[model samples]
Target: MSVLEIKDLHVSVETDQGTKQILRGVDLIINEGEIHAIMGPNGSGKSTLAYTIAGHPKYHVDSGSILLDGAEVLTMTVDERARAGLFLAMQYPVEIPGVTVTNFLRTAKTAIDGEAPAIRTWIKDVRESMVKLRMDKSFAERNVNEGFSGGEKKRNEILQLELLKPKFAVLDETDSGLDVDALKIVSEGVNRAKENTGLGLLLITHYTRILRYIKPDFVHVFVDGRIAEQGGPELADRLEDEGYDRFLTETPVG
Candidate 1:
């Protein structure tokens, strides 16, 4: 069983205001096949934790370790992390103007597997995943996220997830800007990835709508740059009903 452990992680970023600390002493563990939802208010550091784990150069790791099945993730480069079975789906997927979707997916698959996929089977897999996500056939030829609708970009992220088959995926607010149907389709893609590959998930979101479909095995309430509370699916239901009002009391934003 693969285990992704975050031990007292502290992260910071250099802002125009100068150095700013984001994640403060965050800790969690995600075993393969577990879906862990991280819910928090705006500016509560949900995205910080996701980007930190992915080793984004912008986010500085002040201290602590990110371990994946006994390997030190903090020591790995961004691509090394991906090759090691770590994936991050950004909130705003950037447009790669010169890169077609098919080319991008194939390149990523090859990079992660350390060898190119067989052409015939790889094309078939991409098409199947796109069909499952309700993407148009022409989407395979379009530049990645270039002029795509919000829902389309989000669906494409899931398409990559399904194709890449990472051991753990960190989705940063995938539900944002998606309509109900789009949200359901994206969630289905995520569930399919989990069922097919036992993909552990670190889903970061402000709202609980996605949880209704993805059904997190554990729900963590993030407040003041840390996990203030944790529970099962029931915790998400409570957050949906009550909102983050209770947790807002302790946030001393300067």
Candidate 2:
């Protein structure tokens, strides 16, 4: 089974005020077919952890290690990480102006698999995934995320997740701007990916609404750049009702 291990990860970012620490020391293990939710308030280092795992240049890993299976992920480039079966769905997916969604997906699949998928089957798979996402057929001809709505972009991210079949996915606030219908559809797509491929998810979000649909096996409460608490799905429900105020109040001051 595929596994991702983050051991005492301390990450920082360079800002005008000088280097600022974000993630203090995070340790988490995700196994195949497990959904782990990292819920926290804004600036609580939720997004930083996601981007750090994806090897975003803006965030620097000050110490510790990120290992996928047995290989050290910190040593891999972003694309190399993806090829290594790691996928990250960004909160704000960028637009590729000239590349059509079809071309982009096809190219990515080819790169990841080290060979192009059979053309007929590939087209069929993409069409089915889009239809399930409620995307119009014309979206395949459009530029990647260009002129797309927030919900559309999020759905496209899941489309990639479904088609790419990554071993692990770090979905960062995928439910942020989606309406109920869109949110449910996107959630279903994520569920499908997990069910079909045994995908291990590190779902990051502030609210529990997404949890109602995705149903994480573990809920981790991130506070002041560290995981202050952890539990099962009940923790998410508690956070939904109680909010993060209690954790915020007792955060260790530096």
Candidate 3:
């Protein structure tokens, strides 16, 4: 089975004031087909972990390793990491002004697969995935995320997720800005991707609402740049009832 491992990962970023540390000694292993939920308060290093795994240049890895199937992911470039079957669905997806959704998706697919996909097959796959995500056919001709609503942008992210079929995906606050209907649709799309590809997931969120739709096999509570507690799905239920007050009161461990 494919596995993604994070070992003693310590990360920092440069701010105007000085270098600010984010993730500290975060160690977790996600085997294929497992859904891991990361819940934490603001500034708890949840997004930092996501961006760090995706090799965002701003986040510096001071020490430790992120390994994918035993390969060092920290050593790979951003595109190289994507080609290696690592995917990150950003909390705020950026707009690609000049690139049509069609061209962008095809180009990304070609890069990841090392060859252009057969035209008819590629078109059909894109259409089907888009339909599943409730995206309109006209969206194919529009520039990526340009003039799109928040829900549209998120659907576009899951569109890439389904079509790209990565080994693992880090969805950083995907439910943000989504309404009840949009949330359900996006969650279903995510579930379909997991079922189709058996991709492992690192789902990060502040609220547990998304967890109701996309159940996690493991729930990890992030506090002070590291995991404060971890448990099964029951933990998420408990979190919903009782806030992060319990975790926040405890002193952080190095």
Q: Which candidate gets the maximum TM-score versus the true structure? A: 3
Looking at model 3, report the run of 10 residues with the lowest lDDT sum.
245-254
Tell me each candidate's RMSD, in Å, in order.
2.1, 1.5, 0.9
Q: Which has the better lDDT: candidate 1, or candidate 2?
A: 2
The count of backbone overlaps in candidate 3 is 0
Tens digits of per-residue lDDT for model 2, 5-103: 999999999999999999898899999999999998889999999999999999999999999999999999999999999999999999999999999
Q: lDDT value for candidate 1?
A: 0.93
Number of the top-ranking candidate, with lDDT as the measure = 3
- Candidate 1 lDDT score at position 151: 98
lDDT values, one for every candidate:
0.93, 0.95, 0.95
Q: In candidate 2, which residue pairs get closer than 3 Å at backbone N, Cα or C atoms, i.e. clash?
A: none
Q: What's the distance in Å from true for residue 29, model 1?
A: 0.5
